[model samples]
Target: MDLPRSFTIRESSHRILNPFTDEKLATLGRALHLAPGTRMLDLACGKGEMLCTWAAAHRVTGTGVDISSDFIGAASARAAALGVADQVTFLHDDAASHAATDPVDVASCIGATWIGGGVAGTVELLRRSLRPGGTMLVGEPYWRREPPDQAAVEGSMATSKDEFRSLPALIEQFGELGVDVVEMVLADQDSWDRYVAAQWLNIRRWLDRNPDDELAEQMRAELTTAPVRYARYQRDYLGWGVFVLMDR
Candidate 1:
C-alpha cells in the first residue's frame, strides 16, 4: 500500500522524511566511515535522500525500497541528480516483501520501523540482509521524559506511554536484542521544529492553491491546531534518532 494522500501532501517538500536535517544526515554518513564500495539496503527509504547522498559522497552502492510510487519516482530523480544513478536503485515495493540478492554492509529501516512491527522486529528484519559485522540503522522515537498526563500522551501522538521507552531504556533494548550501540544522530528541538513546523507551511500553501481539493479542509484543520499541540506536548516529550548498531 502507498502512503496516505494527506501525508504526501503534507510532506511533499521534504527530501528526508524523518526529523533529520541535511547536515545531520551528512554527519551520520561520514561518521559511518563507509568504504568506497560499501553496500546498503534501506527499507522505507523515503525519497532516497540517504542512499543517493551517501552514494555520491562515499561511493556506496545501494538499493532503496518503498511502497510509494510518487516517492520512488522522486528518489530515482534524486539519484540521477546526485550523479549516483548507477550506484543506487529505488524500487516502489513493499519493504516487508523485498529481499536482497546479496548481503549488505548496512541495512536500515529509518523512521519506519513499523515495517517490521516495531524496533525489535525491524532489527531482526534488517539483520537478515546484513553481512557479518555490518551496521544496522534504526530510526525511531523514544520519550525524552515521562508524560505526566493523558493529554501529554495524546499530544505526543501516542495512545499510551507504553508505546515508547525512554532514551536510556531504548539503548538497553538494543543491548537486549544482541546489538551494540555504535553511533547515533539525534534530533534536537530545532531540528524537530524544522521538521514539524514545515508541515504547516506546506499545508497552508496547498490549501491556498487547492482551495476546493477534497483534503483541503482536513489539512486546514491540522494547520490550525498542530502547532499548539506540538509546543504543548511533542516538542518536549518526544526524542528521535537514527541509532547505529552492530551485532554483539
Candidate 2:
C-alpha cells in the first residue's frame, strides 16, 4: 500500500512531489478564491503540502489520502509544523478505493491519474466527491510538442506519444467529459528541472551513505542518465499543469 521504494527515496526531501512550486500552488489557491473552511479532498496528496499550506493561508480544511506511508507521515508532520494539524488530516490508504465520506468544495488528484486508469476516469472519481458547483482539480501532462521519434518518447518516460494529448486536445478532453476548464497554471521548464534534477542529488546523497543498498545500482544508473534524457526530451516535449474544472 505504498509507492515503490525507489520513488520514496528519490523524492525523500520533496515537500511538493510534482513540478508545481510553492508559489504556483499558492497562486492556484488564491485563484480559486477559497473561502474559510472550504472542504477539500486530495487523492495521492503526497506530503500534503497543498492541504497544509491552504489551511494556513486560506483557512481551508481538508483530508489528504496517499498510499505511501512515508509520505503520509511526512504530511502529518508538515501539518503539525505549520500549526494547522487541527485543520487537515492525512491517511495512508489506497486512493483508488478511498471513497469520500462527505461531499467537498473541491476534490483534487494531482499527478496520479492511474488511480482510476486515466484522466477521464480520474476526473469522474474526483467528481463523485464534490458538492454541487464544487470544483475538481486535475494535474496532468500534455504534449508540448510532437516528439521527433520513439527515442524522444522513451526519453520522456512515456510508453508512447499517444499517452499524452496536446494542450488544445486536452481541453477538448474536458469538454468531452462535460466539464469546463475554468483555470490552469502551467509548469515551465525551470520548474521541471527543479523537480527532476533534485532526484539526482537525493539519490547521490543516499548512495554516499548506503552504497550497498539493493536499489543502489538502479539509482546509480538513473542518476547517470537522467540529466541528458530530461533536458533533451522531457523539458522540451512534456508540459504539465493543474486544471481547475467545473460543470458547464
lDDT of 2 at 213: 93
Clashing pairs in 2: none
Candidate 2 lDDT trough over 10 residues, lowest sum: 1-10
lDDT of 2 by residue, 1-248 (tens): 67899988899889999998888999999999999999999999999999999999999999999999999999999999999999999999999988688899999999999998999999889988999899999999999999989999999889999999999999999999999999999998888888988888999999999899999899899889998999889999999999999987
- Report every candidate's CA lDDT: 0.94, 0.93
Worst ten in a row by lDDT for model 1:
1-10
Per-residue C-alpha lDDT of model 1 across residues 1-248, encoded as one tens digit per residue: 79889878878899989899999999999999999999999999989999999999999999999999889999999998989999999999999877788999999999998899999889989989999999999999999989999999999989999999999999999999999999999999999998999988899988999999989888888899999999999999999999999999
Model 1 alpha-carbon drift over 4 Å, by segment: none
Can you tell me which runs of candidate 2 are displaced by over 4 Å? none
